[model samples]
Target: MILDSSLNITLDNSNNAVFRILGEERFKITNAGPDIGGRLQFSNGRYIHASVQDDPDVDELRFKASGHLDEPLRIYGGSNYNKRVGIGRLSESPSRPNEDMSRFGLDLQDTGNGYLYGLRLTNDTTGTGGSNGACIYYENSNMYVRNFTGGPIKFKTKGAQAMVIASNGCIGIGGITNPMYTLQLGFVNSNSGGAQRHANWNYLNSSNNSFKQLNGNYGNISIFVGGHISINGVIVCVSDKRTKTNIYPMNPVKSLDNLRLLNPVHYYYKDFINNPSQLQAGFIAQETKHVLPTSLEMAGQSIPNILASASYYVDSFKNKIIQFSDFDTSKLELDNSGNFYPYLRVFDEENDIELPYWITISKILSSNSIQIETKEELPSRVFVYGQYVDNFHLLHYHRVFTTFVASMKEVDAELQKEKLKTLELQREMNELISLVQTIQK
Candidate 1:
């Protein structure tokens, strides 16, 4: 059936007209002219509203409307416009037969006014036990969610939360429910090695921060820069004494005696091209190890290695009673197998008690210069032990100052005793001269 009219024609009193081709209304102009708004026919069941002026040559479709528009104008895929499908911005006109501008996605831009988001994507399916939330899913797997307004970004797996960025900008990894730190990892198995975590940062194309943990006993956190690490910020490595074990009592006097062996010298850094002459007072690790062998180890080794071997070296001698009555250097035979370190035997003058203490040896460095030949992570090159890497200079100076103060106190006491003895001797000589004069008279 076909109908063609040149003038105003209406098939019904409801002011509706339809033109059909092949039993389908290919074109429908709903209202009268000058108020024209309806669907225009495009091939493959696609239609565009007459309210939009679309240029197919450039893939541009713009809405042309007069006066104030409604809150939102939604364009859906089907005839009812109920299901939500993303709209793509075309680079060229789709109406043109020669041009194929087919790109499917949404483009959101923010110009000003701090508009939270230009586009919001949401999936609200609540009745069938599915959560009503906003998420981005790929390959049938829900990956991430922008759940709340101005809230943390979350990563999820099958609706189970795996990670979150807190509102205060703290990041949490693993199944960590609460993230109270800058970077936190939790909910890991005690012996699992499969769930390794890493964070990488490149700063100014010069410095890099990297961390990798292969279980609790093995891991490394490295921050490096062009063969040298310069930390502009404070780095606080936790040093709670409770984490340590088998700590022996320290002898500050023995420490003072061993410290005298260190060479105080003026030197320049060989690692840098612009070398500056500096004054330094410390022992070389290899040299000091010869004198205090039990106190030193390689840079990467764990601390308190001597404690682990102490029982093997000292346990047998604990039960035996040995005494040295006289000093005879010629008859003494040293045991080469025994580990020897300095111990101070002090008699407390004020308390009248015997105090024996092992020296608190401050292990020094073998190499003070950075290795300039390589730009890789070198754990053996960088040295740190018990929070005293760059700050070892301060500890060495403190030992020097305390030793000076102790020596000054001893000198002052000796001078006072000598003055009193000299006065008494002078009085006795004067009394003897007076008796000799009386006998001569």
Candidate 2:
């Protein structure tokens, strides 16, 4: 039956109604009307457009299906137009949706100018619209995981937060949520619960809080929480024969002569100046550089202008002192005056030797001319060496030890020569005694 010129309906042998458009089969309704279960099938290249009337109660265009809808309803397009499916707004362009609506979902844009050929998970449905949300997108051969809000991106495992990348670009591993540095590793508890476990690169044991490196053949380098460090194997420097050019044996005698110029001294650091019990034995880099220049390196340092003065004075306690008038008292630690203690050296004319004294800031007599006290009486002319200063001469102790070994070897050789001379003298004395006894016979 042809009700309209464009629509044609025909009844099959099974009494099913088949509808066609322009004489072609487009829709088939099986099992007829009044049946509880019926099937509506559409042909290829056919579209079913649905829309709800402007009723307050009806808000959706829903498709009711009796069985499971296993495949998705796909929209096919020709070469004339781009295919796009939007939930919030009907987008004219394939790249983004209409700017008026807040669309949030996945968008596979296929445009030339904006977001080219990739998948984007965006909140605003545009290329650059989200401000308070995060997006994981791929654009122009690059993939980006960006967070516009001031929050962290966390990665978890087994329902526990394992790692976090903070908004400030700090990465924290092993359940570290708030990292203060560029890369921080958190401490994790081991199964034994005896020590805290770190990442797989290193293991930190509980005893002395020793941290040891992993995956080394010779054994690990262990560094304790305190100042102690231990190496399991011999430490070898890069002294390969192929890397060297002009190498020669060092002169042991010359090294001994140079070593004699270095004066080893027992002194306390400025922090321990008041106690005096925590004394350290070392050579002043400035003095040692003249003897073994290779063992010293010059580095830039800053010092307080008050301690840089060359003036000296004797206090009433027979101690040598230097007073500074113009200085920031706030910068100078008044409670811990020993930290600013200056090392003073005086030449004793009677003993014909140089004596060292530690000078401490005893009194803060106003901003002008603060008084200082020394541990011993200083001579009229004294040389002051201030540790708190700019441009320090730092000593490389490994090279210093090498030079000391050369010097000691030369001393041992000289002792061997003296013993040979003593033996020769004793042989001559024995011969002389034997000849005198022959003359007496």
**Best model per lDDT:** 2
lDDT of 2: 0.52
Tens-digit lDDT string for candidate 1 (253-335): 55545556655565544423222335534555556554455545432211211111000011252321111222221222212
In model 2, the worst 10-residue window by lDDT is 71-80
Which pairs clash in the backbone of model 2? Answer: 301-390, 301-391, 325-369
Whole-model lDDT per candidate: 0.38, 0.52
List RMSD in Å for every model shown.
21.6, 22.6
RMSD of 1: 21.6
Using TM-score as the measure, which candidate wins? Answer: 2
* Per-model TM-score on C-alpha atoms: 0.34, 0.35
